[model samples]
Target: MVDTTLEGLSAVGDTTTGFDHPGLLYHDRDDYLGGARAFARAAVAAGGPVLVAVPGSNLAALRDALSDLGDAVHYADMAVAGRNPGRIIPGVLLAFAAAHPGRRVSIIGEPVWPGRTAMEYPACGQHEALINAVFAGRDAAILCPYDAALLDQDRIDDVWRTHPWMIGADGRRPSPWFAGAFAAADRFNRPLPPVPSAAATLPYVVIAELSRVRAFTAGQARSAGLTVDQTEDLIVAVNELAENTIRHTPAGGTVSFWTEPGHLVCQVDDAGHLVNPLAGRIPPAVTSEGGRGLLLVNQLCDLVRIHTRPTGTTIRMHMTLTP
Candidate 1:
C-alpha cells in the first residue's frame, strides 16, 4: 500500500503517502534471497542507505548479492547483534538510519529464526511489536522478513499484527491482519519465572550494602564456573541494575544469581515501576542525559527478561557458560 517496492523506492521520502512503512515480508529461501537483493539494490539505486540485519547465513548471501553496490549496503549478524531485542533498535535500526538523516534509510531486519530459544521468543515478540511505536512517523522504512518454512503458523500470524503492511508474491499491500500494535505488544509483557531454588539469593538495603552484594556475587559466579568474560558481563549487569535502586525509598531491594546447565543468570528486584515499556530497548541519543545503564546491560548479556508493574520491576540478565 505504501513504499513496499523492493525493485525501487523512489517514493520513500514522500511526506504524503498512504499506509505506513514497517511491513512484513514472510518468505521461503528463494523468495527471501531474491526479495532481499532487490530491496538492497533498490535502496542504493535511489541513493538511500540500506541496512540488512539477518542471521549469519542470510548475511553471507546478501553480502554476495550486494557486494557490488559498495557502501550503499551495510550488514550485521542479527543472531549476535540482535540476540537481545532490547538492543536491536538503538544498536541496529536507528544507528544505521541516523547516519543518513537527510534521506529515508531502509532496513531489512530478521529478528526471529527457527532456532531462537523459548526463553527468548517472548522478548523478540515484544521487540517486533515495539518497532511500530519506535518509528511510527519517521522518515524511514523497515521491512521485517519472517521465515515461513522455519516458523510455525502461529508465529506467521503474529507477523501480520506486528507489521502494518505485507509484501507477498502479489506485491505489497496493507495488512488486514494489523491491529493496535502496541496493545498487542502488551500481551507479551509478563513477569519472568521465579528464580530457581538453587539460586543464590540476597537482599541489600542500601548503596553501602551493594559492594558486599557484589563481592558475594563475584565469588558465587566464579564458583559457578562462569568464564572470565562472562563473569565481567554479569558483574556489569548487576551493578547497573543495582544503581537503579538508589532512586527507591529506604525499603531496599533483592539480588539473585545462579548457574543453570549452560547459563548464568543474575536478577534484581526494586520498588520502582518502569512506565515506559520502550525504555532501554531504544538506545539514547548522543545528547541523551541519562538512560545508558540498562542499554549497556542488554548489550553485555546474552538474553534478558523483565517484568515490571505498579509495584516494582524485576530484570533477569543471562550469560552463556562455555564448556
Candidate 2:
C-alpha cells in the first residue's frame, strides 16, 4: 500500500507527464518535512533517484526521519551549493538529473531560507521563477521548500506566482495565483544599480579590444582599494563576460567598473538577450562544453545579476572588497 504521506507527491505524476519545473512550498516544519519525505518515498517506490538539497540542519532532519531509507536519498547542503540561487540549477538540480537520463528524479531544494539577505532575496525570487524556463520539460521534479513562518507574506505570496504547484502537509494543489512565472520573474528584474560617479568606464566593440578591457578593469579595481585577491577576481570576471559579449554579439559591448563602500562592481552589456536565467549559475559537467564562464564569475564574486531583454543583456558582477 502507498504511504499516505506520499499523496500528491508529484502533481504531474512521472517523467512523461507535463508539469511545471518548480513547485512552491509554503510550509512550516511538519508540512515541509512531510512533503520532503513523501516525495522521496514516492520516488524510491517508483525506482527513481532522489536528491535532497537543503540546509545542513534540514538534511539531518530528513535523514533522521527517514533512517536507513534516508540513506537512499542523496544530500547536499543547499545553503552552500545554492548560496547563489543562480547556481542551484547546474550545481544541484541539473547535475542530479543528468546523472540518470531517460528517468525522472526528485529534488528538494530550499534556496530562499530565512537567513537570505534582502539584497540576495530578489535574485532568489527570480531564480524560483526562472526554473520553469530552464527546465520547462524533461524528467525532473524540483520541489522548492519555503518556510512560511520565516518568510514574509509577500515572499510567500511570490511562491504562488512563480511555481505551478503549491505543496502543503494536507496535499498538493494547483497554484490558483500562478501567473506567468517568467513574466513575474521579469518584473523582479530590476536594473543593475548605477555605478558610482567616481568609478571608471571602458567601452569596447571588438574581440581585439579584450586585452585593453582586462587591463583597465584590473587597474580600476586596484585603484578602488580592492585587495590582490579581490582585484584578480574582478579581472577574471570582467574578462570572461567581455569575452562572452564578443562571441555572442555582432556589435560587441561595453565594460564598466566602479567601487562602493565595501564592494566592487563591474558590468558588461551587449546586444544579446540571455533568456536562460540559470546560464552561468550551473557548473559544466565533464561532457559539457563551453558554458563555464558565468559559473566562474559567480564563484569569484559575492553577488551577480543579469538583466536581459530583446534589446540586449547586461551582466553585473559584485565583489566584496573585504573578507
**Best candidate, TM-score-wise?**
1
- For all predictions, the C-alpha RMSD in Å is 3.2, 4.0
How many pairs in model 2 have backbone atoms within 3 A of each other, for residues 3 or more apart or on separate chains, i.e. clashes? 0
lDDT tens digits, residue span 259-291, model 1: 777887788888888778887777777898888
Give the poorly placed runs of model 2, Cα more than 4 Å off.
1-27, 220-233, 246-252, 259-262, 270-300, 310-312, 320-322
Give the clashing residue pairs of candidate 2, or none: none
Query: For candidate 1, what is the lDDT?
Result: 0.76
lDDT winner: 1
> How close to the true structure is residue 243 of candidate 1, measured as C-alpha lDDT?
70
Q: Candidate 1 clashing pairs?
A: none
Q: Lowest-lDDT window of 10 residues in candidate 2? A: 1-10
Q: Candidate 2 lDDT, tens digit per residue, 196-239?
A: 67656788888789899989987888777888887888888888
As a TM-score, model 2 comes out at 0.80
